[model samples]
Target: MSRGSLFQRAPIPEAKFQKTEDVTKERDADGKKRINQYVVGELLGQGTFGRVKLCHDTVTGNRYAMKVFRKQQLMRKKDFQNEGPGRGMSVTTALSKVYNEIEMMESYSCHPRCVNLVEVLEHQDSQKIYVVMTLGEVGSLLTYDECEGTYTAPVPGEWIPASSQSTQCSSRSSTSRGRSLAIPEPIAKCFIKDALEGIAHLHEHGIVHRDIKPDNFFITTQGRVLLGDFTVASKVDEHGRVRGTEGTYSFMPPECCTPTDESQEYSGHDGRAADMWALGVTVWVVLFGSLPFQKANLKELFESIAECQYRIPPDAPVSPEGLHFIQAVLVKDATNRLTAKDALAHPWVSTADFSQLPAYIEAALKVKEERAKKAAEDASVSGSSSFTGILRP
Candidate 1:
C-alpha cells in the first residue's frame, strides 16, 4: 500500500464446489439454482469462453458476478488456431491466461478502480472454473445506450471538406448501433479518469493491460467505474517492453499494426505507451461514438491505423482541452505519447473540478499527482528518459 511499491496481492481462497449437474438442478425455496454456498440467478453476460451469472452468498446475501469458463472450450484446438490474438496458442498457454487474469485481479483487489476478486472455485469433474467478483450492477460502459447514441450531424450551412486520400477508405459500420453517439463531456471525463487510474495501477506494477477498450471497463451501481477483463494482459520486461501485437485491431497503436522493425515477427514495443494509445482510442470512442480509424477491409483498417489516418469530425462536441488530451496520447510515435501518469496531469483531466467527482476519482487524482511528482524526480536523478518526450502544440 505504500507509495512507490507495487500493489500487494491479497489472498484469494480457492474452493471445490459441488458437481455441476447437482448445482444446476438443486433449487432452494426461492427457486434459484444452488451453487455451493451461493444461489445462482439470471445470466448477466457471456463471452467466447463462458458466461457470467448473478449470484448471491447465502450467508451474507451479498451479490457477485460469477464468471464461469468451460475448460473444454478453453482447451479447444480450433480456438487456438483462430487468426486473432489467440492464434497458435497452446492449451497450456490458454489455461494460464485465465489464471493470469485471476492473479492480476487478486493482486490489485485493494485498488478501488480495479475490480475485486472474492474467491475462485474449480469443478474438475464438470470441466469448469468459477471466478467470483464484485458485481458491476450498472454493467460496462458499453451497456449504456444513451452514451452510444447517434451523433448530431454538422449544421446544414457548415462547409465540411471531403475526406482526404489518407482517410478515403470505405467506412465500416460498427457492430453496435448508434455508434456515433457521444457521451456528455462531464460524464466522459469521469469514465476516462477511472480508466486512467486503472491503467496507472497496472503500469506501476510493471504490467500492461494489452486490451483496454470500453467493454473492459465496468460500472458499479454506485456509478464508480472499475476496470476488469484481463484475459490478454501481460507483464513488461525490465526495460518496460513487451513482445507481440496483442489487442483489438482498432485499438492497437501504429507500431502494433506495422512493426517498426520487420526483421522480427513480433517486435518489442513500449508496453506502457501501447496502453496509453488504447486509452486514447477509448476516449475517442466515448467522446465521438465512432472510431477515429475505420475501414471496410481488414488490411485497409490496419493501414489506416499504421498511417495514423484519423480526424475529429469538425462537429465533434469535444472541448479544446479534450482535443489536446486526445492528441497528446494518440501520437503516432509511441515514445512521445503520454504515459498514464502523465495523462492524469494533462490539462483536461487535471483542471477538472473535483467537487462533484466520485470519491474514488478524487482519491485517484491525488495519488496520480503524487506518483507523477515522484516519477519526475526519479527520472531527473537517474537521467532516465521521460515518457512524455515532447508535447505537440
Candidate 2:
C-alpha cells in the first residue's frame, strides 16, 4: 500500500492485516522516507510526543509497537517558554533538540531489560517519524504514583523512566484505600524492582537515565519493567554544557533545583546522580502514594525540594531502611549522593529480603485481578462501577 494517508492509530480488522519477522525499513525518492503501510492495529497508547499502536508486519505476521511522532505537536511545545504553564523551561530552547531524544532511544534498542529501539522511519512528506519498537506491556516501573491511566511510550530523547511517573496524566491519581485512592504496598514494590532492573541495565551500559520518575515506567500484564523515554539523555562529560535544563520541574535533580553557575553549564552533574534523585522521589511516591513534595503549587514544591525540607509525617509507614535509601540518593551534594552502583548495594534495598517480595507482588496482583473481575461483573450487572490511578514522570 502507498505511504500517504494514515493518521492516528486506529484498530484494523484482523483479516486485513499480515505479520512478518523481517522488518520493513526503507528509503524513498529524495531519500526522505516512506515509512507507512505496515497494517496498524489497536491503539496501544498516547503521550505528549506521540502515540503507540499495536501493529502487524503485513509480510511476517509479527507484532510490534509502532510509535508515531507528530512534528507539529512537538514544534508547538518547543516554544514552551511563552506558555503560561510551560514556564521554568530553560531559555534558548531549540525545537530541534528533540531529535537527540530520538537518537538516544534508537541507539540503545538491544539492551535486554531496556526497551528495544528497533527501526526509525519518516513519513512520506510530513515531519513525522515512525519509530517501530518492541512493546513493554508492564513497561518501565513507575511506582503506583505514575500508574493512573496507561503507559505511553515517549519519543527518542523523552526517555520514559522505570519509576512510574504520571506528571501530566492526571487520571493516574493515587488511592490510599479511601474507596477513592487505596494504594497497597506490595504492588508498589513490584513497580520499584522492575524499574530498578531496567535502570540497572542502562547504568551497566554507561547510559544514565537522567530523568527517572513514576510516569516514565511502563508495566506489562505480567508486571515486567521496561525503562523507556531516552530523550533528554546525554553522555556524562567532565565539562558541563553551557546551557539548557531538559527536564520536568518535579523530575529535575537537586542540582537543577537552582542554577549555581550558569556560565559553566549545570549539566556536568548529569548522570547517575540525577537518576538517583529521581529514584528517591519515585520511592517516596510509591510508599506514600503521592509526591514527596506535594505542594499547593510549583513554587512551593521547588522550595521544598530545594531546601530538602519536606516532611515524612510522624504517622507515615516509611521504613527506616527505605528512609535511608531515599536520603542516600536525595543528597544535594553530588559527591555525597549514592551512585547507581552504590544504590544497588545500599542496606535498605539489599537487606530488605527480596524473598518475601515475590509473595507481596503475587498478593497485589491478586488484588488487582479481583478488582478487575468485580468491575467486569459490575459492568454486566449495571453499566456502572468504580476507578483508580496512573504511571509517568
Candidate 3:
C-alpha cells in the first residue's frame, strides 16, 4: 500500500444506539442493553472521559470491548488546558486524536499482533461514541501480577562491596513502592519478541506508535500479545520525521524531552527511533519490574534520561545476553539505537526457546523477515538510480 494511503482518515458511519431508560443500568427483557446488533454487557473499565463495557455480538456469537465516550465530557475545554502530568489538548485536537486512534486500529486490523477494531457506533442524539474492539482477556502488561509494582534495590552494604556501596547503592535504592518479582527471563523474552514484531509491522508502514509501554500491550486467552491504545501515534512524513513530543512522559526518548532549535519547538525527530527507545524502557520494566530511569521530580527524570544514566540493581537477575540487548536499544544516540528487526535478531531474543509459543508468533516473525528483505532491495534499487543520474550529468 502507498504510504499516503496508510494513514488516510476515513469517516466512521454512525450507528444509532437503541434508546432505553437509564442506559447504564436499565436492560431489556433478555437482560442486556442493545446497541444495534451488539448486546452491551457489564462495565469492564472506567476512565476520565468515558467507560469501556463488555459487549456481545448476537449474530456472530463473538465478544468485544466497547469504549463509550461522552461528547460533553470530551469537549470540556478546562480538562484539556490543565497544567500537570495528565495534560489535555484543545477540544478539536482531543476529538481528532480519538478519531485518529480509531482510524489506525481499523487500518491495521489484519495484523496478528495488533488489537483490531470491530466497529464504531455514534449516537448523535445522545452525543456519544462507541468503539467496539477485540477483547484482550488477560488485561494490560502493567496490571498483570508478574509485571506490576516496583523493585527495591538491595541495601547499600548488602549487595555491593563495602568500599563503593555508599554511593552506588544509595543511588540505586528506591523507596517508590513495595517490591515485586520480575517476569522470568524466558517468558519476558516471548513478550518482548511479540512487542518487537508489532513494532516492526508499524515501522514497515511508516507509522510510529509513540506509546509503547507495558500499559498499552495486552494479552489474549490464546497467549498472544497484541499492541493497543494509539491515541498519540502518528505517521512519519516522507523524510521520516514526526513533530511534537506526544507520548507517556516516562516512556519518551531523551530527544523528545530536549528541544532541537531556538524556537523551543521539537523541530521534529526520528519517530521510528523514538519507538525503539520506548520499547527498550518497556523491556526494562518487564525484566526488572521497574523503570530504568525514574525520579519523583520530572526534571530529574528528564536529566537522567538525557544522560542515559541508569544502573541495573545489583541484585536484579538479568543474564548477560539480556543486558546486552537492553544496552543496544537504550543508547542515547538515536541513530545508533537498534531497530525492531535488529533487536529481534539479538542473541538474547533469537536464542530464546519459542517451542511453547503460539504458532501465530512464528508466522509473524517470518513475515517480518520477508518484509525487511524487500525493503533492503528497494533501497538498493533507489540508490543505483541516484548514482546513474549523477553519471549522466
Residue-wise lDDT of candidate 3 within 1-393, one digit each (tens)?
012222332233342223332233246797777877788975656554567778888899998888888776666623242222233343344566677887766555457687777777775566778877777654555442325345321111122233332332243344412333355555567778887888888777767899888877876656567888777787777656786677778888988765344544334678888999999998888777778887868898888888888897665445668778888989898888998778889988887665544543343344435644676688797874211000000
Residue pairs of candidate 3 with colliding backbone atoms: none
Sorting all predicted structures by TM-score, with the top scorer first, yields: 1, 3, 2
Query: After best superposition, candidate 1 residue 246: deviation in angstroms?
Result: 1.6
lDDT of 2 at 113: 52
Local error of candidate 3 at residue 360 (angstroms): 18
**TM-score head-to-head 2 vs 3, winner:** 3
lDDT of 3 at 74: 66
Model 1, range 63-179, lDDT digits (tens) per residue? 988887777667662323222242334334566678788766655445778767776777556777887777765555643233643222111101112222112112322232222
Q: What is the Å distance of residue 145 in model 2 from its true position?
A: 8.8
Clashing pairs in 1: 149-181, 179-289
lDDT of 2 by residue, 212-298 (tens): 776666655445556676766754433322133456677666666653653442334445566777888877765655566666677
Q: Candidate 1's C-alpha lDDT?
A: 0.66
TM-score of 3: 0.71
